[model samples]
Target chain A: MEKETHQNIESIIEAGKMNELRKLLIGLSHEELERLQKLLNDPHEFSNEISSLLPYAIRKMVERGEISVDSLLPFVEESMHKSIQKNPQKLADILFPVMGPAIRKAVSEDLKRMIASINASLESGFSFRSLKWRLQAFTSRRSYAEIVMANSYLYHISNVFLIHKDSGILLHEASAPESKALEADLIASMLTAIRDFVQDSFSNAEKGTLDEIQFGSLKILIEQGPYAVLAVVAEGQPPADYRVTLMETIEAIHFNLGLELEKFDGDTEYFKLADKFLQQCLIKQKKEKKQKAPYQLIFLLLLLIAGVGYFVLINYENKANFKRFITELEATPGYHISSSRMSFNKIYLKGLVDPLAEPVEEIMKRFQKIEPGTLQASFEGYLSTEPEILQRRAGLLLSPPEGVEMKIENNRLIISGTAAADWEQNLELKIAAIAGITGFDISGLNKKITDLQWIIPSIERHRFLFDINVVKLDSLQQIQFDSLVQAAVFLDAYNQLYSRNMAIYVRSYTNRNGNVAANERVATARAEGFITLLENAGVKKALLKSQVLFAEDLRETVSLRTVHFSVFDNKPISR
Target chain B: MIKKKIAMLGAFAVGKTSLVQQYVHSIFSDKYQTTIGVKIDQKQITVADQDITLMLWDLYGDDDFMKMKPTYLIGASGYILVADGTRSETIEVALQLQEMAAATTNNAPFLLIINKSDLSETWEIAPETILRMQQKGWIVLLTSAKKNLMVEEAFQKLASLMLNPY
Candidate 1:
């Protein structure tokens, strides 16, 4: 009974302490008592309870605008990154349905832009406006295309780029038709680097920015945003509202793609949607100008065509003239063309020409196609066989004296009219030398035969009688001697004028009464004495020859012993 | 196509341009070296079946006229530190440029090239020094731009590293 009372006392004290704890917790709210009960139980039960109300609590926080999305953005990006890293193929599979159409649209758009630009360029070619633009380009030292763009448009946005601000990476690019495209990646990075360099050199980058970069007529307008930068490569001056457009574009990009920009890696596939916004910035306005006909181009074309046609006509005329000249040369007997050519509008001819043929210069004078100082000719002299040429040659060679006429008929030379004895003597020999004359006819010529023809025979028939061994001219008739000397001189003169060789021979005959040797000596002396007398009388000694002959007449006749005279021609006579 | 910006950093007259000329164009000129502040060149290479366009920024050597501009290396994906094998002091300048590159490019991938290896007989950099650099987890290659030795291999190696960074 005593031990039971002691135990009861300890239990009572414990109960009293619990009672005191229970009384201390009595003032707590029901939620506090339940939290304390849960704290004393399994830890998983607390998790389960919090999880059940977590969505509601977050909703309340978000609805009340008490939660900062910025604070949660990093976690969401990290989770998505982890998901993609876990299985990249899953994201790729999700995007596969739209990729084909997107790529096709991009390619078709590029092709269309190229075609349109090509058409525009072709249409503007050789136009008056294009010519003016070309002139402006030349004076200003700019490209024709650039000048055309500058003059045709009031302002043109050629290219637009959406670049990541921090990494200097190009996210998207847009351009107008035929805009000069550069390596956007490199340009973006270099642009960023240059901006950074300038900002670092001048002031902090956060305070101010590079608003514009002007080079010639091109202006690189930059609009900065929180995550991306919008750059416009504009030709000509853009209006103030253009900047407003850029600002709005950048703002829209940032607002729409804030989260994506924050988590942007090297993958730009998502930014491709930004092309539409960029394309909107590729704005252009044309300058109003009067439409004028391309008179200058038309005139230039007409001038070119006319010039070419004139050159062709002149060439054809020259060729025809050359052909006619060659025909004329071929037809004429004395002219033979070895070579004929035209160069630099000049005609050159090389041929053989007979001296008797018609002059080539005379033929050239007939055609105005041949210009003076533009004809070069080389010719070799030659004899011709034509009848006309032969007649002219015969006339030139014979050179008949006055009152003498010569003509060629049937390749035969016909002489008609009076001719001197020496002239007639040379006609037959000269006719043989002419190429085309078969023979000569002198039947119609009234031959003078000169007074020498009769005088020479009369002198030859009458010989001077010399004494048997006297060797003297004492018995010679003075009148007859003088007549003989006159006839000899006249014959020598005729021989010299007609290129003839004629001589008078004096023969002495000795009687048989003397010995043969004595007779020969007497005959030689008699002939030499006669020659001396003739030479002293003004007759040429060369015209007289001395000869000796012993008569075989035993009768010793006086006629045979007398000296004799004869005439002989030294040259062979053809007639 | 993936594009990466690479920077060439070195001391003056260290064969950086020569190595680039050899690797990119496979040509060499014996004319005197001309100083240029910066030059940009591009070449396409294939690594692991992926095409990559490398934009090479050949910066002026670190010297008094124009010290290395950190701004030039802002978007560089990798860099190559070139030093003349005949000059030991150039290694220090290359190291200094490497530090600047690291600071500006967030410690991007890089390679150390001891150039003019054809003149190894006249090298002032000892083998021990190169061994030290190698031991410090740096990829070092000996190249002779004059001989076209290891130029292609060096660029390809850097491209691969850039494509698949550690």
Candidate 2:
């Protein structure tokens, strides 16, 4: 090491090893260098090269959180301050372009917040105020939604902005008449810088972006996209769904002005139609706060007055009607009010409501729609639940028949009262209709309404032997005519006593010795001859009814060929 | 089958209606009627073994009184600019109309048709004026609706140019 330590001795390039060193180095080839130099000289190509990585660089910067838009906001404010102090006349011209957009941004946010509030109110249950608004909205000719906005929405958008995403330059603007005075360019730059700074700083750990900023009551809402961002400032929270509208605007700008936007050099004259997109943001302002406010309040107040009036009236009507129902129920017979109280829609009557007294359930039903399964009838009665026993007992105790006596003995009804006639006559019709009526004995009744009084209710058959189908009566048969006369008199007495029209039914049967028509004629003639004899014996023609009955056995058997006599009342009397 | 829309653009009362009537119906009407809104009519013809349906949008002529709407020329494959040879100003109007049509049709193939050639004695348009347009690479034709001369050929020329752009 101490023999030759020449520090300046160059062994690599001194021996014509420059080519070897150049080959080992990482320098570009000559042709490639020339091309690169040319590319560097061209400004368009240089910018184009950087532009390719602009999006990625911007994203990386945003993710790092090392930069923020606040850093550049001072520059914007300084520039405007300088203009105001140094070049006052140029201030208007400098600020003219930014005014519309600046105000529009604020208004857009205000309008958005109002919309969000309205939606929130609707999503929640209706308060008194909200319900009033809903009713007003229904009555108005306008749509319910429009009326709701008119009532609940207090903020509006006076202007809107469309700014370039990369350069933060105002592309186009829309504004109401009142927002014509503002500096939109400076605001756009400040907003962009703020967005950038916020995105780059504290937001580095995550991909989340700043969505809002607050200053006093004024607020700003930021909506982000891949290529652009929209900032809105307002006094309240913006509508959550306004993002869809803003997104659509961004999409349209991307589609229609995409090519232009990429190569844009701060010229916005071509984007004249940007107002069309921003007009959506410029919702008509709520006219004079006091004026619109009073009108809505008055409407709500009037609606509330009417609603309260209706509710009071209905409550009064229901109370009055319920009182009347209670009074009527107490007055009704068979209803005993041991304890009666009305709890809401139910009427609890603990009194003894006699089941037999006009039927408690039926009494409740008489009043339509008043009682629907609300009647609870508990009656004090005999141990038996049978309807017959209940009916009999109730009838005897409530409205006992006049001058009538009843005894249910041996499971057979025994009655001595004169009104027992009425009860006995209804035995086959109504009293037996009860479920548990075993049987009845009217033999002890005084009036004898149950007496077998109609012609003894028996068929009195009188047979006469006819010789060779001749209908003439022989001497022996003529001897029986007195009995026939006596039978007619007896039937007449039965009719008078029973208070009915009892007729003598004489049915004559003919032998089957000839044609049916001829035999019927023969039998009819014989019946006529017998009637003449009965008429001479004092029987009325209306009381005598005759008919010819045909039978083949009558032709062979002498006993079978006969005239049958039976007495019957045309109208049987129950009394 | 292919649908090719064509426009009839011209000056006010410049025989545009007459030319369309002649080309579409092959019939002549002596009535000098002014068209109002665009009158749309269609006709089918065979060209190069393909059926071509021609939707003829006869746009109302452009004038100081009634300027035609250019939206009517949208989706047009070709157009015919009709001018009355008797009026030289109508030729200028035809050029203005051609500009409007070209804007909407995306410069579709077109023909400049000078109508009313049958009234040659009363002609006001100069021959040099038409020659200058021809030199500027314009497809020009002289048609007479009254005589029914070269009217169909004028429309066919534009149609063929559109179908076979060269």
Candidate 3:
């Protein structure tokens, strides 16, 4: 009979007929129903066929509105036992659809009410215990009923309860058992809600208020929450203060819901006050914006008026001062005046001085007085004569121990002197610019003073053997003589009859055609004769001395005159 | 043509921004502006026959924030680790950045910029500190944004380091 009844029950379930299965079960004797219930409850004896029919039966009960907290309790307990006997995972899957939504709804409603009550209590100063009682009463009815109906519903439901508790909703003692089953789940869900709230509050909260709240605990939740919550919170405030606060709140909710409630109260009030403060700030910002507009306009208008006034005053003062300056300038001699405002004054004075016209130095001095502390002027203007300026500019070129002599003759400046330094070329350029000069005759200057010591040594060596002549010529003639004698003396000193191949010639001719005739032949002959005399003095044939001849116009003559000198070794005596 | 990567490293509260501002904008701000993440700026300079574009990255100095992976150090050719001359701890931070750079990448050339030299009496990091850094093979320089001292030279030295790696 039991086999037949089990077969019938299986058939009824297979046909998707829960009503038939109930009818079939009711028709059985009490003993048979007991036996079948036991068999169904025992998963080892209950075939997979029967277990499969269990979900259909429970779904039917739920659809028929017959699966109340009490009504579904037996089936849930039996199913749990059967699931444990067979496969716990399969049982969860089989039970999920029939009980998942209802449990989730019950828990979500319970948590929502709890959160609302907590938030209201915080805002309205309602007693936390009273709010806790009300939330417990509100949540327990559905939570207990669902827990009795489906033990698998405990996971999601527990999470909802804990989240509600974490949100400051107190849990009733009666619902605590179901909540304990959901410890991990509740902590996860609560952490998620807390993290979301803290993050949102942080991002949108009043700027200064967030600093007062602790976010350190929230990171604990981020580390310990469900995968979903962990993932989201990880992105939000990984280890930030908000995450820290969330973590602490979750821990408090788990270990002590009362403390969690207290913290929630504090956080909620803070958020509220921050919101009000932010609104007030927005209003103040609007006021400030409105107030700034007119002040800015007034400021701009004042600036414009000041600018116009300053320009007008500056122009008027400049005009009045220019008239006075023009009157004073007109009194000065050799002054040329030009002013744009003079036409307005109707004072057209020819040859009047231009007030702006002055030496650069005077202009710079006046500018310094007008604008004190101005940088030094870079203008290079001077009022001295060109020659003086040139001399000053050439100051760097003057070598030590050099003197210059200047003479003016026939509107031509003649500079005649010997310069003992190498910089005489540079000095000539300076002295050439003397005033009233048509041209400068600098040819009379000698760059070096002839050294007589060189001649003295040669004279000492050749004094007893030959007559050596030394002649000094005019400046122009001396230059020619120096050039000519330099090569001859160099050759003779090194190659000629050491001391005896020497003769000195000295002659000064008058400046006339007759003088040229008188001296030219002699100068030539003396040069040639010196060479011959060196040969006669037993000097080597290849080493002979010669003479240097200079030509100049004597003081009384307009024609060229000649002077000759014979150098032996370094000296010349009268020949 | 290798782009010059210039990293700006400094302690928690030094005027690295002031130095950068003085160099980049010729301006200074007395207020401290906290940085959260790395900021990037670019400047072009001509050095030794090459037109180098300096890619300057300004990194956060807060030690706690440094926990995040240092993605900013990648591809950096050179570094300018700035420290407050008035704070010795900042020199320590600069040295830390030097070690971080070495550990993260191969030993990249770097310049140790001791900022705020104008406040000489207030300087907590002594000249000996700079000499010590130099002894450790760091290119050290002293600068002052307030007086605009050696600010350009600091940047130029780091830029040159990119071309002639250490």
TM-scores of chain A across the candidates, in order, are 0.35, 0.28, 0.17
lDDT of 2 by residue, A515-567 (tens): 87887787887777677767877887878888776666544443435776766
lDDT of 3 by residue, B39-132 (tens): 5555667778877656566666746555423345644567788888888888877776778787664677788888888888898986687787
Candidate 1: misplaced stretches above 4 Å?
A: A1-126, A134-145, A203-207, A259-265, A290-575, B32-37
The lDDT, on a scale of 0 to 1, for candidate 3 is: 0.50
Residue-wise lDDT of candidate 1 within A250-350, one digit each (tens)? 98788667788886644567888788889999998877666788999999999999999999998998888888878877787788889999888888889
Tens-place lDDT per residue, model 3, A102-157, is 89899999999999768754743466544555565567653433322232121121
Q: Is 2 or 3 the stronger prediction by lDDT?
A: 2
C-alpha RMSD (angstroms) for model 1: 27.1
Query: How many pairs of residues collide in each model?
Result: 0, 18, 30
Model 3: runs farther than 4 Å from truth? A1-575, B64-69
Best by TM-score: 1
Q: Candidate 1 at B41: error in angstroms?
A: 2.3
Better candidate number, 1 or 3, judged by DockQ: 1
Candidate with better DockQ, 1 vs 2: 1
Weakest 10 consecutive residues of candidate 3 chain B by summed lDDT: B66-75
